[model samples]
Target: MLEQFGAAIQQVNLSTPVLRLFGTTLALLLFVLVSRALLSKLIRTGIQAPELRRKWLVQTRNGLILLFLLGLVLIWGQELRTLALSIVAIAVAFVVATKELILCFIGSLVKGGARSFNIGDRIQVKDFRGDVIDQNLLATTIMEVGPGKLTHQRTGRATVIPNSLFVSEPVINESFTQDYVLHVFTVPFKRDDNWQLAQQVLLDCARAQCEPYLESARKYMRRLGDRRGLEVPVVDPRVSLQVPLAGEIHLVVRFPCRQGQRSAIEQAILLDAFGSHDFSGKRKEGDEEGEEPSAVIE
Candidate 1:
């Protein structure tokens, strides 16, 4: 009778719905714990490539966690379904609140993956032109350049521009194609100061000082023309005469030069030209001797 009673009790225990569900939940919990341990070991010791390993670990961990959560939902599907509306409403509110921040982050991702431009590159956007000093998720900082005392000169100020603007505005990357750029500067001389001789001297000085840059510029320009169908300009130094003001004829000299070395090249050419002749466009009051003139900008 005791044996019969024990057997009947065991059968009842197996038949109970709540007891069976509890046992199943315990088994699933155990499975999850064991699987998590194995996956962690695999991610820590198995992967070789650093980048791939990081990506794999993140994706796999997230997937596993999701599966674990899904299993729980299956166990408690009725309970979670009741809260689904609240979950979706909270998600929508959060997205709307952080819309601009999210957009900026997306812009940064696009910039990094696309490689639109890089640090030290000279880029112009929205009337702001400068060398990129720093770039982050939200904005880019640049050392500003402009006209007058700021002509191709830093203003000792940093301009921070938002990365989101890159989506709509055009970016002029001067340093993207090559390290050298075509720099044009005009040297003005009085009509009486042998303008013809001044042109020849200036031309010779440019050819000598900018020899290295000229060769590279031509090669890059040719490559651009072939690859992008751009019109390749004449690479050789050219000096053209322009009379934009009275009593002065300007010799516009165009040459390929390093972006960082523009001022140095201009100074060198001016010094060399000054030694040859009095190349001045204007003289100060009561000036007995011819004063050295600087390059003029329009």
Candidate 2:
């Protein structure tokens, strides 16, 4: 009787092979979910060390999870060789089906991983100029700034642009290096306010106002590069003098700026210059409107 009972139990256990397979699959699904959560936490912890690249770690983690799943399916679902072939075929089909999407996703991944730009980066991708707000597999969301001038102070309208831009256009990342820009205030003496003395005064003032910013910018740029594992600084404030249109000598000074500060900086420079000197536009209200006399916007 005991022998017969043990034999019966063995037969019953082997009867539901499909049920066992389903239970194993369920367990695997739970494992994958738990592993993903734990892995994310691990990645966050690892980001503290400066030497380790977070992007590479994330990529490796993803690949490991996928390989684990693929191996499990091949071992438990059916014949290993057949399962392997089917997976390859399916991957090829998926790539062909979503070619454009794959390319865009790859591009975004590269852009993000390299720390090329951040959420508030002022980037001009093709023709859509704006501050980046969101990035994902398909599209990048941006708040449109302007057309010719590319100003960021706007009415809160955002645009969703495709990641794979067809236009072969340049993407300008303003403040990709440093913030705190400079603008020169030209104060021309009316040939009587001691032109040389006035120039000296203005130049000295500009230097004092902008030098500190330049030094700070350099230091910050260096720090940023070091933190991100980038090797160079992409921005520097420069000031110079030139005579292109003919008038009082033009002092050209550029300072670092956060996004959307160009116009404000220009206005501030104008106000400061006016407070110290007389700036009679002299020409008619509209006479030099577009003629662009000795005035240089850049």
Candidate 3:
């Protein structure tokens, strides 16, 4: 192409193309740097529009810099167009060589760039749970929790999930719409114990612990309503005890929790609830607390 187009323009020595390429590249670098600096300064100082603050400068500067680069490239006339077309063909070949990686990158943007989940948001996708540590094109990383406290299968390891998972897996975003989580605890019931009275005592304890969260949920919902155009939600505390599984009464405690604090917070609540209550179906003068001859509910 260079030979074919030589007679259409100024004739040069054997070193002409090399010198022109290097010189044009250097000029482009200088042009880009100068344009970026001036654009950044203008966005920072000249732009006085208060409505366009925080992120306005970066976007404006990028636009100006791109325009400057495009103009600089256009200066080469027809020769540059031919070169650019050849470069585009080579780039297309390169992309075809790594199609999977490009797809992964696009999938990552769709999943992570949507602001769907944050670092501490409690999310369950496929078979993983915990706080997300790092999300990238190839994989999403999480600090796994909840081993045997709630269920038998322990997800105690940091797992890397592929970006394609969002398209297929049912992602349970616990903190997506609400900050308060319902914690259901079930305990065994004894035939000899006064079930109603026992329920009241447990209710009072659960209510006291969950009161702050209920208030928090209300305040958060109101803020969400005002700021994000969301509907206001009311928080309700609930407890259900049922006699089932091996003839044991399950003491269920429903309460609110911060987005990422489910497993640890639940464990803490269980500890405190057990510490304060004598859930033991039998009562003796020297009997210890919560030593009931029934199975414990998670």
Please tell me which predicted candidate would have the highest lDDT against the true structure. Answer: 1
TM-score of 1: 0.54
Q: How high is each candidate's TM-score?
A: 0.54, 0.51, 0.55
> What residue runs in model 1 are displaced by over 4 Å at the alpha carbon?
1-115, 145-157, 188-195, 227-229, 243-249, 280-298
For candidate 1, what is the lDDT? 0.74
For residues 1-298, write the lDDT of model 3, one tens digit per residue: 9976886555556668767877886788787778777877777786676435324554455456566667666655666667886698788999999876776766666776676775555678866776566665577777776662353123668888777677556677655755555555555576555444455555566566666666777677678778888666545555566777555555666656565445555566556656767655555545434443333222
Write candidate 2's Cα lDDT for 97-182 as tens digits: 99888778777666756566666666777667777766655677787776544343654779887766622334677647535432
Error of 2 at 284 (Å): 17
Winner of 1 and 2 under TM-score: 1
**Candidate 3 weakest ten by summed lDDT:** 289-298
For model 2 the TM-score comes to: 0.51
> How much is 123 displaced in model 2, in angstroms?
1.4
lDDT of each: 0.74, 0.58, 0.62
Q: Alpha-carbon error at 133 in model 1, in Å?
A: 3.0
Please report how far candidate 1 places residue 148 from its true position, in Å: 5.5
